[model samples]
Target chain A: MTLNWKSGGVLLGVVFFLAVALVKPIGVSTQFVIFDGILWNAINPDVVTTTADGFTSPNAYLAKSGGKYAEAVANPINYSFIFVLAMMVGAALSVLARGGLSREERAMPELWRSTIGGSSLKRYAVAFVGGFIVLYGARLAGGCTSGHMMSGMMQTALSGYIFSAGAFAAAVPVAMFMYKEV
Target chain B: MTSIILAIVIGAAFGATLDRVGATNPSLIGRMLNLTNLHLMKTILLAIGVGSILMFGGQMIGLVDVGHMSVKAAYIGVFIGGLLLGGGWAMSGYCPGTGVCAAASGRKDALFFIAGGLFGAAAYMGTYPAWKASGMLDDIAGGKVTLGTVPGASYEGLTAISGDLLGLAIGAVFVLVAFVLPDTASRSGGQVQPAE
Candidate 1:
C-alpha cells in the first residue's frame, strides 16, 4: 500500500510546518553525537561530568556549545534524543499497520537487480559504507538532510541553500556514474 | 514534560510520513538520485515548497514567532561536508533519519547502516580537536546570516529584502518546478517494475 507521491509530499510538508511553527526545527545528526557521548561516557566515567554549570565533558566536541552536548550525554531523556527513538517506533508501526511488505518492497529493487545484481550481503555492505560517509559528513556540517537542508531551507537559512547545492552537485554525478545502465 | 510528549508525536508522524513516501526504501532513493525516476524528487520539492510557504507566511502575520527560527551557522566545513554527504547519499540510498526509519521497517540491511553511522559519529568525535584546529568550523559569509532581513530574528540578512517574502517566492518557484517535472528523466526508465 504505497502512498501517492503528491499526497505524501503534502503530508510531509504539513508535518514539517507544524514542527517549525510550534517548538523548534527538526534535527537528527546531533542525536548521533549524543549517542556517541553516551557510549563513550559509559566506557570512560570521566568523559562526562556534572558540575554546578550543569554538564561538561573532557572531550571538546561534547564540551562545546557550552556543554550542551555534554548535558545531553548525561541526560539522555531529552526532547531531541527521545524524538529520534520515537521516529523508529513510528516507522515500525507504519510497517506493521500495513500488514506486511508489499511484493514490490520485498524483492530487490529493479534498479539494483538490473545494475548490480549480487547477494544481499553486497547491498548491506554498501549501505553500511554509505551510512558511514553520510553521517561523517553530517557531523562535519553540523546537520543532516533533515536539519540542514529541509528545515534550514524552509527557514531560508543561507547555509541551507549552499548545502543543498553542494549536495546535489555531488549526488547527481555520483549516482549517474554508479548507475550507468539505468 | 509537554515537550517530550510532543517529540514522540512529531517524531512518529515524521517517520511514518517518510515510510509512506518511500524515503525509507533504499532502492527508491537510488532511483530518485540516479534520475531514473523523479517521483521522490517532486515529492521532496513540493513538500519543501509548501512547508516554506506555511512557515514564512505564518511568521509574516505573527502566527509563528520569529525568535523560534533556528538558522545554522555558515562555515566552509558545511559546504565540504555537504559534498561528501551527496556522494555518500548517491552510494548508500539512505541518510541518517531515513536510515533509522528504514531499519524500523524490518530491513536487516538497515541495521548495518545504523552501526556504520554510529561508528562514523564516533570517528568525528575522536577527530574533533583536529577539525577545530583546522579552523573550518569558524563562521563565514556573515555567520548565521539570512537571505533577506527578518524582523526580530537574531540573524542578519545578506540583503535588505524582506525574508518572509523572499521565502514565499522561492517556495512558489519550487512548487512550480515540481509540477513541471516529469515522472522520469529517461524514457527507458519510465516506471519502476516490481521484482519477479
Candidate 2:
C-alpha cells in the first residue's frame, strides 16, 4: 500500500486523541484479560467455576475483589484495551477498503533469514518467543509500551519515560540485526 | 452500549491508522529502530504531546480527574522486565498489541507471537511460587507516586511547575529531531511488526 508521512501523522494524531477522549488511552495490557479468563478456567476451575444457575465461584469473586488476578482481569475492560482493540479493527478495515488485503509476496531480509532460519515457521517461533518476553516485561513493569509511553507520558509519569527508554535501547540493536540484510 | 460501540469504532480507526502508516509492517518499525525513518517516533511523540496537553489541560479545568488515574511505581523487577522486553522487540520485531493487530490483518508470524505470549504468561503464572520464593516479589515499592506526592504541593501547583519544564524539554527535542531526520521509505523484511 502507498504510504505518505503527512497523512499518516494526521491519522495517528486524530486516532490517538479520539482514543483518549472517547474510547480510552492506548495500551496493550487488555489482551491479558482474554488470557486471564482462559487461564482462570483452566488452572483453578474452582476459582472460575459457574453454578448451574449462573453464579460465579466465591473464589472468583474474592480473586476479582483484590489480588494480582483481579488487577489482571480489571485491565481488559479499561479504556486502554478497548483502544487497542479499536486499533486492530481500524487497521483491518483500512486494508480491506484499500484493496490491499490480498496476500503479498513474503519479503525476507537475508540476515534475518540466516540468523532466525528461513522458514515461516521459524519466523513465527521467533515472534512467539519475542511476544512472550515483551508481555512478561509489560506485566512486571505495570504496563505495555503504549500504556507506559503514550498514556503514562501524557500523565508525566517517570516510569513511562524509563519504560520508553528501556524499550528503545533494546529495540534499536535488535532492529539493526533483523533488518541488516534489507 | 455506547462505550462498547465506541470501542469498536475507535479500535477500527486506530487499526486503520497503523495499517495506513505502514506501522503494521515490521520493516517500518525496524527502520524506526535503526533511526533511518522516524515516522513511528514522530507519530508517538506527537501523540504524547497532544494527549499530554489535553489531559493536563483537562485536569486543570476540572474536566478530568487526575487523582483517579492509575500509575505504577518504580521497582527493580520492572527494570529487569523492561530490559528483557526491549531485547525481545529488537530481536523479534513485534510487541503484544501490535502482534494481535498484525495477526488480525492476516500476517502469519504475528499469530506465533500471540501464541508465544500466551505461553510465556502461563509460564510466569506456573512459576509464581518459585519466583516469590526467590524473593523476587519481596519489598517491592512504589504506588501512584507523582511529583505532587514528593513534596508540599497541591495538584495544580505541581502541574504548573512540572508541565512547563517537561513541555519545553519534550517540544524542543521533538522539533530538533524532526528537522534533523530525513524521511526514508520503509524497509522490506520477513518479520511481522508487533503491536506496541
Candidate 3:
C-alpha cells in the first residue's frame, strides 16, 4: 500500500537526513556524467588514463579536479556510481514487494489523459525530450534538485537557494502554459 | 566496503521513499507543478525542511561533521541551467533521480527518459569547453559562500549569523508551509486523486 502524503513527506526527510549525517548529501545527476564517462572510456580507452598524479582524461571536463571524474570513469564501482545503480534496484524491489506495477501506473496516467489528451506514444516522446533538457541543464548547473536544491538548501547554501528560485521561476510558468484549464 | 554497502542501503531507501511518495509517476509531478495537486510538492518541502533541521542541529551538537558538507560554486550557468531544468521538469514528469526510479518501477516511458538523460549528459560533456569559455561557469556572488557562518566549514558566510540557526528557521518555514498548504489549489477540487 502507498503512503499518505504526510507520512511519505516525513519519511523522505528522514532518509535524506540519514544520508547527509552519515556519509554525504544525496545526489544523482553527477552519476549521469560518470555514466557517460564510463561509456566513453569503454569506447575509447585513451579517454581516461593513469597519470603520474592521478587519473586524467583528454576531455577537460573529465580531467578537472585532478581527473577525479576520470577516475570514476576508469573504475565505475565507486560510491556515487553504485548509489545510482542501487536506486534502480531499490525501486524495482519496492514495486515487486507490492506485487507489481498497478494498472494506473502501467497505463497512461489520468491527469495526462484529461489534460494533455494524447496517446501514450506522444507522452513518451515528450517525456524523453523533457528528460534530455533537464539532464543537460543539470550538468550545466553542476547539480539537480537533489543536489543543489534539496541538499544545498538543507546546508543553508546560498547557491542552493538561488537554484531553487530559478527552478520554480521557470517551472511554474511552463506548467501553467502547458496544462491550461479546459 | 562499508561505504559501498551504505550506498546500497541508502540508495534503496531513497528510491523506495520516492516511490512510496508517488514521485515515480510523471503525471503526479505535472500535477504538483501545475498546482492542480500539491501532494507531491508538500512531501518534497516537508522532507527538505526536516532534513535541514536534523542536519544543522546535528552539526550544532557535534554529531555531524561540517567537513562533509559540499557547497557547489554559484555561477551564471547554474541559474540559467536551473531555469532550463525547471522548464524540462514541468514538461517531463521525471528528473534524474526519479527517472531512474520510475524505470525500475517498470515504466517503459521512463526508459526513454533515461536514454535521453544519457544523451543530454554526453552532449554537455562534448560542449563543456565552450560553455566554460562563455564565462557562465565563472564564480559569482561570493562563490561557494553560505547564508551564515557555519563553524568548522571552509565556505565563507555572507553574514555573521549562525548558519545552524538560519537553517533551522528556514526548515521550520518549509515544514509550516507543508502543513498549511491545501491538497489542491485547483477550484475544481476536493482532494484530488493521487497518481498512485
Candidate 4:
C-alpha cells in the first residue's frame, strides 16, 4: 500500500512537529467538551460558571483540565476547538485530492456484511452508538487516543501508558470476538 | 480570528496527513486490530516514538516547554474510559479523532458516528451530577502525575527516572517494535482489500 507504516509514520511525525511548533499539543476529545459547553451555554449559561476567577462544568473530569472547558465555552475560538475543526478540513482535502471520494465507501470486513447484512440503517446505528459510547468514555477519562495516548504518551506520562495498555487489552479481545465470530 | 486562521491551516495539514496515512480507513483499522496487517499499529508506534523524541528533545533545546506540557491526572476513570474507547474502536472502526476525519472523508457511517458521539456527549452532560457524585471522578493517584512522579506505581520498587530519559527509552522501544513487526496481517476477517 502507498500508505504503509513507513510512509504513514513519517507523515504523522511531520504533523506532530508542526503541531508542537505551532501549537501547545495535539489532541481531539476537548473538541467534544467544547461541543457540550456550547450546547449548554446556549441552553443555560449558568451551569458552567462558578465565579469571576473560574467556571465550573458538570463533569469534574473536564474541570481537571484547569478550566479549559470553561474557557473554551466562554471564548469558543481557542486552540483546542480550532485544532479539532482543522482536522476535518485536512481530512476532506486529502480525500478529494486522492479520489477517495469517488471510491465506493463500503463496510469494512466480511463481518460487516455477513453479520450486519445490507442494512445501511444498522451500519449507521452501530457507528452512532459506538461513537456516543466512546465520546462519553473519552470525556470521562479527560482525553481520547490522540489527547492522552498520542500527546501524553509522548511525554512519557503514566496515564498515557496505562490507558494505552488498557485500551489494547480490551480492544484486541473484542476485535477477535467480532472478526473471528467467536 | 488569528487563532481560527491558524487552526484552519494547522487542521488542514493534520487532516490531509491523516488521510495520506490511511488513518481514515476503517478496513485498515480493523485489520490492524485483527493482527493481520500490523502496519497501522506500527505506524501509530512510530508516530508516538518520534513524537516523544521531538517533544522531550525539544525541551532540552529550549524549543518546547516542559512547563506547558500537560500531564493528565493518573486516575482509574481514564483506564476504564480507554477500555471503552478501544472496544468502540474495534466494534465501529472509528475513534473520536479518526471518526471526525472519516466524516470529513465523506463516509456516511462516519458522519452518523459523529452525530452519535454528539448525542452521547449531550447525554453525559445531562447526567453529570449523578455521575460526578459517584466519586469515580475523584483523583485516585492524586492530582496530575507523570510516569516519573507517580506515588505508588513502581517497577521492582525502583523509583521513577527523569521524564525525558523515560521518554527516550520508550521511544526507542516503539521504534524497534515498529521496525520488527511483520508487514503481513491476517485478512481472515474481510473481503475488502487495502485501499489503493
Each prediction's total of clashing residue pairs, residues at least 3 apart in sequence or on different chains, is: 0, 14, 0, 8
Which residue pairs of candidate 4 clash? A86-B11, A90-B15, A90-B16, A91-B15, A110-B190, B36-B185, B36-B186, B37-B185
lDDT of candidate 3 over B40-142, digit per residue (tens)? 8888889989998998889999998888888888999989889888988888878899999989898887888888899889889899999999998999988
Off by over 4 Å in 2: A1-3, A39-44, A49-85, A101-117, B62-68, B128-142, B146-176, B184-196
Best-fitting candidate, scored by TM-score: 3
Winner on lDDT between 2 and 4 is 4
Best by DockQ: 3
- Model 1 interface RMSD over true interface Cα atoms: 1.4
Q: Top model by lDDT, which number? A: 3
- lDDT for each residue of candidate 2 in B1-196, tens digit (9 for 90 to 100): 6776777777777677777777667766766886656766676665566555555555556565544354555555555666777877766666776667777777777777777777766555555456546654443334343433312213232233565346435544543554455555345543433434
Across A112-141, the per-residue lDDT of candidate 4 in tens digits comes to 655446677888888888888888778777
For candidate 4 chain A, the 10 contiguous residues with the lowest summed lDDT are: A102-111
| Model 2 residue B66 CA deviation in Å | 3.5
| CA deviation > 4 Å runs, candidate 4 | A44-51, A54-67, A106-111, A114-116, B149-160, B187-196
All candidates: DockQ: 0.73, 0.47, 0.76, 0.61
Interface RMSD of each: 1.4, 3.3, 1.3, 2.1
lDDT of each: 0.85, 0.60, 0.86, 0.73
Question: Model 1: runs farther than 4 Å from truth?
Answer: A102-110, B187-196
Sorting all predicted structures by TM-score, with the top scorer first, yields 3, 1, 4, 2
- Candidate 2 on A1-182: residue-level lDDT in tens? 53555555556655655666554566675465446555675676555443343334344322432344444343456444565667777766777787744443133323356445677767767777887887777766667766776666665665666677777877777776666543
Could you tell me the lDDT of residue B20 within candidate 2?
76
